[model samples]
Target: MSVSFRLGILGAVGVLAAGLAHAGWLWFAWVAPAGALDPGSAAASSWMPLLVQGSWTFVLAAAVGWQLQRSGQPLQQSLALLRQQVQALEQGRFVVVEDPPAAEALPLARSLNAAVRRLQSAIEEAPGQGAQALRRTARRDAATGLDSRFTFIARLTERLADRGGAQTALLALRLLPVQPGLAPDPRALAAAAEMLHLFSRRVPGAFVGRLCESDLALCLPAHDLVAESAHSLIAALGSGPERLHCVVGCADHLGGVSLGGALAQLDLATAEAEAAGVGALVCRTSHREEATPQEEGALRRQIVEALRANAMELAAFPVVDAQGDLLHLECPMRLRLSPGQPLAPAQAWLPVAMRYRLTTQIELAGIEMALAASARDGLSRCVHVAAESLSAAGFVSAVRSRLQATPQAAALLWIEIAEVSLERLPPRLRNAGTVWQRCGARVGIEHAGAALLSLVRLSELELDYVKVASDFVRGVAEHAVQRERVQGLVAFVHEMGARVIAEGVDEQADLDALWALGFDGATGRLAGRQGTAEALVAPGSDAAACRDQAMSPA
Candidate 1:
């Protein structure tokens, strides 16, 4: 039954056969002839030869058995090693056999190692293809490839109920029917939608949706881009003489209201725009405070005043590991637009800052704050850099000069770029990432996984880590499909030599799920405090709130 037992039986049979052959030879060569002359002499001669043959057989059998056992050891060890590697592969771990136990196993090992390399390559290079698959499975409006009305409403409702009391701006566009009862031309409608899609892509955290056959809506959180974006759309449409009649309206949502109420107020603004004529834009506050050019001019003045007074505020929220050990503090920028007003986060004033070409200045100010805090507190601090600042002529050099000045603080700083920026401007991001890394600060991308194709580009940059977008992290706890996607993302990022962190992880279930999925770190409501702005800008407080809101359904 056993190999050893079978071998022993065959060895014993071979030895007995050898002895019989020797006895026969002795009988025929001497005993047979002698038997005719003297029978007793022949028998005695055969017995002597047989005894010699038996002795040799025993020696040969022992030597052969010992040799077989000695030769099998390497093979046994090789088989065990192969089994372990296979088990690791089954567990979603890519591994290779670096050294074969026996010379004969070399070919098998090489083959397995090649397979592992291929798998790693596929994961590292196939993000775009994978994202296409995700898009196919996700719900989207066919014409515009944006969120459907129902989907948009659901996400908007969620943002409205956010415990963080996030501030949002809701913008709606209406394409009027040509005749009283006739619908707009399909070609014209499609063109307008395409234009809106392009606009949405430019805004870092803007959500656009096809609200109906004749209406499209956009949501901007902690964003003041409603008026600017609406005017841009109207102007873009007006460029063509044959453009359709369009009206745009936006309203600020400071929370504590129903979706219906927000929509009603938005409707009022749209009606006002429609009355102004084709290609008109209007803005209203939740309480019907009109946003006029005078207010706009006043905001510009306030921005200048704040910057002159050095009113940039930085708040640090902790990013932690599974053991609750601090990894780094995520610092979101805030500013005091008016002397007496509570500080406002980037989302509220960034559009105005960018309009005035002050984004680079604000970003540099935030970096300085983060560096100072890191040095003072002896804790690593992170600051996000806007895409606009990266392209600003002297932004990088300015930061570089500052980092060079305070080597210790630079060592403790982490700079992050939005994932969208990386996708659109890989070369620029790479250049910035390289500069920052050389200056001793870590560089990475946040709000990642929005563009899976960007993963391939990550190899082009010197990234230390990437933060998974909150959209992917929000409901991973109970959704198997989402968990699978997250798992794949983790593996790809790990293979590319960058750690993965989860963003917007505000729930315990999501946190536990992320840990199980192998996230390096996480930051959100549950991971640590919401920092100073959220604490100071209480939901109902009269503080000037700047809320950042963007919702992309996965």
Candidate 2:
């Protein structure tokens, strides 16, 4: 029943009970015990007094009944108004409806307002949720069900930023027309589809995308597929049902460089593969890349000439100690394109040296340059010695002979070997490391995470330190997984009597996180050069500002 009806019923019952009580009092006082009292007595037979008192009781009850009806009007009007507003709210109207006129209904209005506000907030956030879904949808290419090229590049950049010495490689593949024809090949679509399917299936989180009609690229995470393994997998596609003829170009994000360099390496490798012939996978592993053996020889001749003439610039990045003092300068060789072409750096040429077994020569040359620079500046300097160079015959004898011949210069030198190359440490390199230690040149490993093998035998090797790979320290500040991994590595290295240095510290925040995680030293774009520790600010000291202004968005 309605609230007004229920209230009306209650009020009517109270009035009826009052009227019955009044009638009962009149009967008891005037009519009861009439026979025992004197007939002429004023109290027993006086009708006028009883009549007056009865009349007053009836008048007072009538007055009270009228007052009750007047008071119930306001309550009835409020309840009716509230009912309409509630119905309106239920029909999806977000407007704040007027409250009941009665002040007592304020509590109900306030509760309804609170509920409406909660729903409104949910409605407000709904678009942002939709935008996030839209963004995810846009990242994928419709044809291959793979990431779009833009998305792929974005992810690669993030991976590069986070590559704490971890390996990441890109595969650029072009589907060649199997049948020699002017029109479209019947096998073209099938071949591209088959290629993408195999790649996505093999690499767990592979980001594969088509750049154009038949130009496709796949980015393989280090944890999944290194460049060599990726090369092998694509080679497997050659024997598949599609029976496709293709050229694959593989480029690895080996070290610090611009995004363009990583992509250009893919282009060079693809060009080289195309020139090699059908079903070939060629990679540009060094600074100098060429399409043919003759062209490679020409580039190699230029490199040799430059190395002999010393036509190269030394770009030294400082590695800082825990105290924010300069520990050593990591001198990377920047060789010219054609002795004076200026643009190409050693990164572009080192792969050529590696390919042709000329790393020993390059290493010897780089060391001489580093030691000269170190002696001239009176600061300790370190140079990378390629793993291939370490494996070369008589490499130890040459290095030892040079060190012995110039002990003063060697004392201020440090040598670094790629950790990936140390998976099978040569006896000669180990012996050479001991000799270098005797000569006061500290030997260490760069990119030291042993993803392929255990570091349980690291103690057996002669090493002064092992740098945590660039990937581990790339986003260490915000990545819990990386932070925990680096923490364990630092402890393990310390236990093994080797110091831990974090590489790829591209931001002040990452640097701060590495320092907090117990690393002995840090180096990257953020780590300042000699005599300047100004940029190694603590995490809370406007770290976000430093991140925003200094580094590109990852």
Candidate 3:
């Protein structure tokens, strides 16, 4: 294969041929034109034969040169083609060589194509084999081996976009934590995660997402969602009404929705199932419901008018410690459309406010209401500000001005923003925190579960505490998985210099569990009843009785 060796073999063969030609010419006396000695000549005239021999030799040499040039054209062409194929391989393309390689390279081309096919197949089969595809992170959930929430959602969005208005079914399975108030065995959580994961693999192209700590969503074509698959999933995830179990809610969409609306539908369906009871499964086959543009505009108009007219009403709820001591009153301000109109709760209109980017005004209104009330009664308050508000132009300056106007309220105010909102624009959040500090007010993140996965990231924010989402705290006393997750979170957050406030601790058992687990404080109706803090809350003390009513539909 070496060039030197090839040249040596050719040289040896050339020498042998030349020696044989000389021997035959001399032995037969081929110097004469007749190719034999002339019997009648004393000394042969070598010149006469030399002329004839030279002419013939010239013709033979010319013919050989033409033959070699023709042969080399094929070699050059094949080599160029081989180089092109190699470059394509280097670039990670597995294209079939449309023009077969020359006979010499054909075997190599075949072998390379075979290797590429094998790698391509491996990439499709193993998520970790993404090197061929050059995708980062293996496009999966590291813990459960399911699709990560972002990946699942993105893939689902692509499918919906491709087949718009197509019938699609989504399963939102909210797993209730079991063996509450104890550290969950990681093996147990893994088993459950894998159970759902395997179920998702029943049909090819199944899309699954880890929506939150306890929520997993599976999206597939409507036709693939049959009773048999449902039964198998329930069996694997633990099906029973009397025991703690994961309840699945199914929502069917009719090509009439975007990804957001479809997800919202699943949420509503899940809520329906939760209300129904254990072993409950709710299915909705309705067309996706969406607010008309006109309706949305009208809602925005109402919120704007209310903000302009100072029509915000405070609904005070108590956040208490384990000792039933109220740390502070969370005054979630609500909006009223016109004079005498009942106030709309945060849930009812916050979504609308967020949608229209009206959160800046809403946050300002909440702070102003809380400040006014605190100044009037000397009560410490925790007021909510929308995360979107921080992005508003001049929002930090506005907060500073509000605080400066009632500097005394600063000491009594705690501004709460949803963790989901705080997650974006770290610089902006840091700036807001700086403003809060300058104003002598405190800020904390609320609804921590949806936006955060680990506690270490909390150090990035300038927050005093994080309110673990109510879903994590609601049944902590009986849910082992929830307890372990919250426990780790609390420990990590403490190390990060922030307290862990468990939200929605209405049950005595839940409260007791959270306290034992080192939760700094908590909030809910139960906490409110036992609160010892002497803070003056809403204008009417009867707001305590309206805790349930305040949260109800307007």
Candidate achieving the largest lDDT:
1
Worst 10 residues of 2 by lDDT: 545-554
lDDT of 2 by residue, 1-554 (tens): 54444554565555554444433433445643434345345443454454555455556555666677767877778777666655544333444556666678776666555544543443334322222232333356565666654456546655554424336677887777656533224466446655666766876766677644456787776522445764665666756765566778887643333243455567668878888887887765423223588877777887788777777766556678767787777766666757347734555565466557676776787788777776776778877775567777888778887777777889888887655455445544555588778877888877555231224334456578887656446656764534554565565566557888876566778877778877888776566532354443333423232211111111
Best by TM-score: 3
TM-score of each: 0.51, 0.49, 0.55
lDDT of 3 by residue, 139-215 (tens): 56566777655456545555544423445678877766565554434555566676667766776667677655567
Alpha carbon lDDT of residue 319, candidate 1?
A: 77
In model 1, the Cα lDDT at residue 235 comes to 80
Residue runs of model 1 more than 4 Å from their true location after superposition = 1-290, 426-429, 529-554
Return model 3's CA RMSD, one decimal: 18.7
lDDT score of residue 209 within candidate 1 = 85
lDDT score of residue 352 within candidate 2:
60
Give the per-residue lDDT of model 1 (tens digit) for 155-227.
Answer: 6655654534467788888888878767767777787888877877887667888766677888887546678
lDDT of 2: 0.60
CA lDDT, every model vs. true structure: 0.68, 0.60, 0.61
Give the candidates in order of TM-score, highest first: 3, 1, 2
